[model samples]
Target: MDSSSEITFDGEQRIGIQKRSVRRRFQALLEELTVMNVQSVADRMAELNPIEGRSHFCEAVMRSQMQFPQSTNVYAALVAAINPRFPDVGYLVAKRAAVRFREACDSRDRDRTETAAALVAHLANQAVVHAALAWDVLMYLLTVYPMDNTAAAAGFCIECGSMLRASAPQRFTDIVGGFRRLLRGLVVDKPLRRRILKLIQADESMFEDYPAIIYELDLVEAGEQVTHMVSLLQPIDPEYSLDSSISSTSEIAGGGYGSDEEVSSC
Candidate 1:
């Protein structure tokens, strides 16, 4: 094995079968960050320039607010599913979700009572706060790694068969493919398929100000975006990814790391 090749989670799921890998990753992160004070993490997140999928995350938050409009289970499920591998992303998504949810509140608006204005403002502030915490978490980890070294990431541990929070996914063409496949698998409802597709394709992450484009589309039209984006995200099949799976991808034997309490709340 290469010196950098380390054991990470195997794919055996503990909670929901689909969630097992990410759950492991999430637990480790909370443990590691306990010492880092979440407030600092939030500050750093604000300075971040949005990444490729950020706009999508932001839009998803808004759509969740608009669509679900009331239930938080979807929000929690999303956070639970994503926070493991993409904690920063999850935090940002949370912040965005809060604002979107508030915006969707029929009782509140800029023109409404001062109480509504204050409430909306408060949620917006909280969004920024969460974003900062998430950012700090990422930056702190980045500092832990040697400036020139990439192998220091907690990365994946095959022994546990779970993804760990210590590192980000390495560059692989297939990562994009895998993400698309995962998103596709998440779609069951006909409406969800369209939203997922639009999210993948014309979303602002894919194209600037794409949200404007989305508002123009009817639900049926939006569904096509999912398929289009999947093709673009993975122009070729992910056959190569499976065959050339990252060296870090190994199966686990048993126990490792933190309590389930912090991670399981989702």
Candidate 2:
């Protein structure tokens, strides 16, 4: 063959080899992701280098969802691996899943709705501690799921709020604002409203500037109840003062009261 033709042939051969190698590696990763054992999948994920494995992790998760559309366990494992390293990718996967859930809800598919709720719940549980991503997922749920699922959506918001209060109080205002905007006109159930109130009460200082917002939502009584509850929970001392400086010091030192507890109680 002429030199020019030989060079072109070599280039084609190199490209072909590269494609095959990528496909093989992807298949291997897929095997690790799809194994019957959840711990095995988690172990393999732990061993992966985040910087190098990010794309592979994304592809594996997307493919896993396609392969096991009904398996919340698989989605949870995949999300748990990706969220800490590539939360944006995790959010994208979650968004797609949410869209699917919305479609199922719109179609009145009971079985599909249940499965979708489970998948979204797993994603929310994995991402709730992450403020930005959690808000995105929570908004998606509130927008997509019907009022029938309002309690679940409210539960997620409470969890997200609790996490933000404990770990990222600085971001609390923005996250709470997002929740307020999304939940403003919706008729939230009494239990859900109570849960939201508890979240606000857990870190009242975070929402101090927005008391009017809470009041306008008809949550004033709930807020008062929380204040009373907190007062009752406090250790009574005649010498103790509710001074701002001491409160600030305590907040700064402990990172916010009840932040270390699980979200269920928050």
CA-lDDT, candidates in order: 0.29, 0.45
Superposed Cα deviation of residue 194, candidate 1 (Å): 38
Task: Estimate, for each residue in 7-108, the C-alpha lDDT of model 2 and write its tens digit.
Answer: 333554453444334333544655554424544544455455433334334444544554455454455645555455455445445555555555666676
lDDT of candidate model 1 versus the reference: 0.29
Q: In candidate 1, how many Å is residue 150 off? A: 51
Off by over 4 Å in 2: 1-24, 33-63, 66-70, 107-112, 128-266
What is the Cα-based lDDT of residue 76 in candidate 1? 33
Per-prediction tally of clashes: 20, 0
Candidate 2 lDDT (Cα, whole model)?
0.45
Q: Per-residue lDDT tens digits of candidate 1, residues 1-266?
A: 88579754434432222232333433333233221233332233233322323433343333333333232222333333334435455445444433332332333331222222222222222222222222222223234332211111111011000111111234222333443575556544544344334444432243343211122111212222111111111122322232122112222334332222333211
